[model samples]
Target: MNKLIAIMNRVLSLFCISLSSILVACVIWQVFSRYVLNSPSTSTDEIARFLFIWVGLMGAAYTLGQKRHLAIDLLAMKLENQPGKQAALKLIINLISAVFTTVIMVYGGGALMLKTLATGQISPALGIEMGIIYAAIPLSGCFMSIYLLKDLLDNLTDISSSGTSTL
Candidate 1:
């Protein structure tokens, strides 16, 4: 499981790096085309936007996997001495995050993607189906859920093995 997670993390990181690099190149080309060539590249602009979306979503998933996402942990830190309280708080937080990501990102995003697919709408400049671009939402959501589940399992194992919690 850890190995799988590690592989996923690496793949996601690579994806983000590639997407960001492409986005930067696209932006530079756009600027050059507009300023130097006196003609903007419409396809590059749309491609950059799509790449940006993928980068942002994938970066978020990568951050979540690393447990680097922002959180207000003051209360958890304060309860460190109380193992039971700390465990409970951590569990509650994980559960809440799981539910939110599952419902909003997973289900909602999937639905939105399907709706767009059914509409058969194509991007103005790229002429690609919009649903393909929107896939980043559910993909990121799945990645987040995977990380959250792993964290939850690890927390439970720790709590059970140590007979206490130390979040």
Candidate 2:
């Protein structure tokens, strides 16, 4: 499992880096074309927007995977002395995250994607199918789900091994 997550982290890292590079290049080209050439490229702006969406979503998932996502840990801090409570709290948090991500992002976003695809909706500037762009939502959701599962399992293991009374 660790190996799989490590590999996923590496892949997502590279994918995000590559997408960021492309996004930067697109913005630069757009600026150059608009100002220097006095003829803005129509496609670059739309391409950059789509790329930004994917990058932002995937980057968020990657951040969560790294355990660097922001948290309001005041309660956690107050429970500093209680490892068992901390573990339980973390487990509950993971469970909640999993449910939300699965239902909203994965299931709902997937339906949206399919509906757009079925309707043959296409972007004006890029002439690409919008479903392809919408795919980022569910894909990122899957990434988040995997990371949450790993966290949930780890917390369960901690609670069990601690041999402390269950909350």
TM-score computed on alpha carbons, candidate 1: 0.93
The residue-level lDDT of candidate 1 at 158 comes to 61
Residues 110-160, model 1: lDDT tens digits: 999999999999999889999999999998999999999998897787678
Please report, in order, the local distance difference test score of every candidate based on alpha carbons: 0.90, 0.94
Clashing residue pairs for model 2: none
- Candidate 1 Cα outliers beyond 4 Å, as residue runs: 164-167
The candidate scoring highest on TM-score is 2
> In model 2, which regions exceed 4 Å deviation?
165-167
How far off is residue 4 in model 2, in Å? 1.1
Residue 42 lDDT in model 2? 95
